[model samples]
Each structure stands twice: as C-alpha cells, then as structure tokens.
Target: LFGYVLILVLVTFDYKELAPLGYILYGIVILLLIYTGLFVHTIAGTQRWINLGFFHLQPSEPAKLAVVIVLASYYSNHDTEDGYRLRDIIRPAILTAVPFVLIMMQPDLGTALMLGILFVSMTLFVKLRWSTISILGTVAMGGAFIGWKFLLKDYQRRRIETFLNPEGDPMNHGYQIMQSKIAVGSGQVFGKGFLEGTQGHLHFLPERHTDFAFSVWAEEWGFVGSVFFLGCYFFLLLWGINIAMTARDKFGVLLAFGLVMLIFWQAVINLFMIMGFLPVVGIPLPLFSYGGSSLLTTLISIGILMNIRMRRYQIKT
Candidate 1:
C-alpha cells in the first residue's frame, strides 16, 4: 500500500525538476551511508541501517536512486556524437565510486555491486570508442580478481567456496542453498497450493519471508505459477526498456534504463542464488521480497518511469 501510494505521488511530478538536485541528493545519501556505517548498531552482523524507531532505514537502498539520477543529470547535459575519450568517464566513475566505497564500508556487498553495475550499465548506453571499452573491461576484470582475493571477508569467501561444493559444508555455509534446491524441486508442476507448501509453512526455509521470498512463492505456486510470475517480471523489464528508448531526452533515457537495470540485476541475482547457480548474496527481489527499503526504492523507480512516460510528448531535443 505504501508502494502504491509512492507511485501515485511521484507520477504526478515532472522528472525534469529533479535534474538540478541530483548531485545534492547524491551527496546527502553518501553522508547517510557514512553515518549508518560508523554509528548505527550492527544488526545480523552488519551495520547497514539507521534505527528510526518505527522502522530501520537502509541508506544504501536509496543511494541507488541518488546515483542513477546524478549520473543521468550529467550525461543528459553533456554528450558527444562521436565516441568519448577514456578520460571523459572519470567524473562519473568518481561520482559512482564515492557511494560504492561508503556502502562497501557498511560491508553490504549486494548494494555495492548494484551501484557498480548501475554505473557500468548506464555507461554502456553511451557511445564509447572501442579502445576505451576494451581498457575499462580489462580493468573491471582485474578489480573483480582483487576484490575476491583480498577484499572479501572470510565468511564471504566461504559463501562462494560453498557454492562451488555444497556437500563440503552441508550444515553450515551450504545449508541454505541445499534447502532452497529441495524446496524448488519439491514444487514439481502445479505446486502444493497457496500456504500449503511444507518447506515454507513448516519453517524449513530460512529467510523465507525476506531474501528467499521467491522460494516461498515457488514452493507454493509450483513451476507453472513460477513461470507466470517470471513472465510478468520479463514484461515489466521489456516495457521499461521500451519507455527508455522512447524517452524524449537523454536524461529520461538514462534515468529510465538505469532504474530498470537496478531492479533487473537484483531479481536475476536473487533468483540465481536461490536456485544454486550463484552464491547467495542478500539481494532482495523487488516487490516480491519483504523489505521496506527495497520496496520503496522500487516503487519510486516505477514512479519515475511513469513520469517519463507521461511527459514523452514534451521532447527536449
């Protein structure tokens, strides 16, 4: 209901109004992330949220929006017909890296990855010289290697190691993935019916209401229903992509596409993690997962998409 209300409220505003405030908003989120990381009490082994009495607020979630808007604001105003020089992206990279570093300090790997991906996705849309793309790609690969080898914490590395060999640690790191697979396999075709899933109802699936919400959904809905749900997600992505393509200005295009990618990768990673194809990262599935911060950010992104769609007739170009 709050999500719906957010969409209704934001859709009525002009997206263009946000252009000037992008950097300011981005800076504000950065400060919030720093405060959360340093001062907020740790919960479940991480200090990722601020205690707001009624509800804990996760600053990193909204940082996704801040980064997207600020990047779009920069790109829309200054663009080149020919491919950009490699040096041109430094500003945007720095803009993205600030929040990335802050969130990483919170030790929230999932949101940090999302920010990095958001930057890369938005950059890809811009026409870049082949040499520049090659250099950046190589740099990205090297960064990943260094991140895995030195930056990842002991438990984080164990998660990936366990993903490779689940049988090695069935009772510890590997437990969740193994159980997730069983639940998925148990939901053969038509499912066991709503609220009747043994895995979820029996409380056998850990984090069933949050990170593994899809597992609960699949265990109850079966393969057919799972397919239907996934199809809807696919349609939403395609629809948002179409909106990005048809957007009147470059900012709208970037904003719409960036927001969609933000939601897209989260869903993809969550589903793959649940199915044992990837290591479990605590990324929540948009709308489907029970998280106040994620749901609010997702709805705001949807609202921005609607804002872009409604104002398409007012082409800036």
Candidate 2:
C-alpha cells in the first residue's frame, strides 16, 4: 500500500526535476549510511539499518537509487559520442566506491555488491571503449583474487564453501540453502497448495518470511506459479527497457535502464542463492521478498520508471 502510494505521488511530477537533486540525494544517503554503520545497533547480526521507531530505515537500499540518479546525472551531462575511457569513469567509480566501502564495512555484502553491479551496468550501457574494457577486466580479476584472499571474513568464506558442498556442513552454514532447495524441488509440477508447504509453515526453512519468501511461494504454488511470477518480472524488465529506449533525453534513458538493471540482478541473485546455485548473500528478491526497505526502494525505482515513460512527450530542456 505504501509502495503504491509512493508511485502515485511520484508520477505526478516531471522526472526531470530529480536530475538536479541527484547529488543532494546521494550526499544525504551517504551520511545516513555512515551513521547507521557507525552508531546503529546490529539487528540479526548487521548494522545496516537505523532505528526510527516504527521504521528501520536502511539507507543502503536507497543508496542504490541514489547511485542510479547521480550516475545518470553525471553520465548524461558528459555523454560522449564514442564511449567512456578509463579516466572518463574515474569520477563515477569514486562516487560508487564511497558507498560501496561504507556498505561493505557494515558487512552487508549484498548491498555493496548491488552498488558495484549498478556501476558496471550503467557504465557498460554508456559503452566503454575496448581498451578501457580490457583494463577493467584485468582489474576485476585482480580484485576478486584479493577480496577472496584478504578481505573475506570467515563466515563469508563459509558461504562459498557451503555452495559447493552443502552436505559438508548440513547442520550449520549449509542448512538454509539445503532446505531452500528441498522446498523448491518438493513443489514439483503442482506444488503443495496454499499454506500447505511444511518447509515454511512448519519452520523447516529458515528466513522463510524474509530472504526465502520465494521458496515458500514456490513450494506452495509449484512450477506453474513460479513460472508465472518470473514471467511477470521478465515483462517488467522489458517495459523498463522500452521506456529507456523511448525516453526523450539521455538522463531518462540512463535512469530507466540503470533502475531496470538494479531490479534484474537482485532477482537473479536471490533466486539463484535460494536454489543453491549461488552462495547465500542475503539479497532479498525484489517485490517477492518481505522487506520494507527493499520494497520501498524498488517501488520508487518503478515510480521513476513510470515517471520517465509518462513524460516522454515533454520537450527536452
């Protein structure tokens, strides 16, 4: 309901109004994230949210949106006919790194990873030169090596280990993925029916109401339901692409596409993580997963997407 309300409210304005305020939003979110990381008490083992009485404001979620807007503003302002070189992306990379490191310090790998993905998606959308791509590819390979060797905590390392061999630690680190896979397989062709899946209702699956929400739904609704739900997500991405292609200006195009990639990667990572194909990184499935912060950010992205589509007829300023 709140998501719907936000959408209704935002589409009333010209999305162009948001362009000028991009850096302002980015700065505010960065400060909020720093406060949350430094002072907020950890809930469920991570200090990713600020306690605001009735609402736990997770600034990292909105940081995703902020990065999209700010990067769009930067890219649109300095768009080149050819592509971005290594030096060309330094500012955006630095803009992204500040939030990425803050979120990483929160040990919230999921959101940090999301910020990195958003940066890559938007930069690629702008078309990087071949020489720049080669440099980035090498740097990414080196970064991955260093991250695994030096930066990953013990539990973070365990996730990757569990992904490869869940049975090795069936009663511990591997438990959630094992149960999630079972829930999905149990659904089969026709599922166990509404409110009937034992894995979820019986507490066999951990985090069923939050990270594993899709598992519960899949278990109850079966293959047909899963396909239908995924199909809807597929269409949403397509619509976002259509909006970007038809948008009147570069900022709108970048904003719409960046927002779509944000949703796209989250959904893919969550589904794969739950199904045991990828390590569990605590990424909530967009819209499907039960999270106020995640839902709000996603809806805002959708609202902005609609705003861009709605104002397609406006003259470019």
Each prediction's TM-score versus the true structure: 0.97, 0.97
Steric clash pairs (candidate 2): none
User: Model 2 over residues 1-43: C-alpha lDDT tens digits?
Assistant: 8889999999998988888888899999999988988788877
lDDT of each residue in 186-294, candidate 1, tens digit only: 8889888899999888988899998888988888889999999999999999989999999988889999999999989999999999999999878999989998999
Q: Once model 1 is optimally superposed onto the true structure by TM-score, how far is the C-alpha of residue 55 displaced, in angstroms?
A: 2.2
Output the TM-score of candidate 2: 0.97
Model 1 weakest 10-residue run by lDDT: 308-317
Inter-residue clash pairs, candidate 1 = none
Q: Evaluated with TM-score, which candidate comes out highest?
A: 2
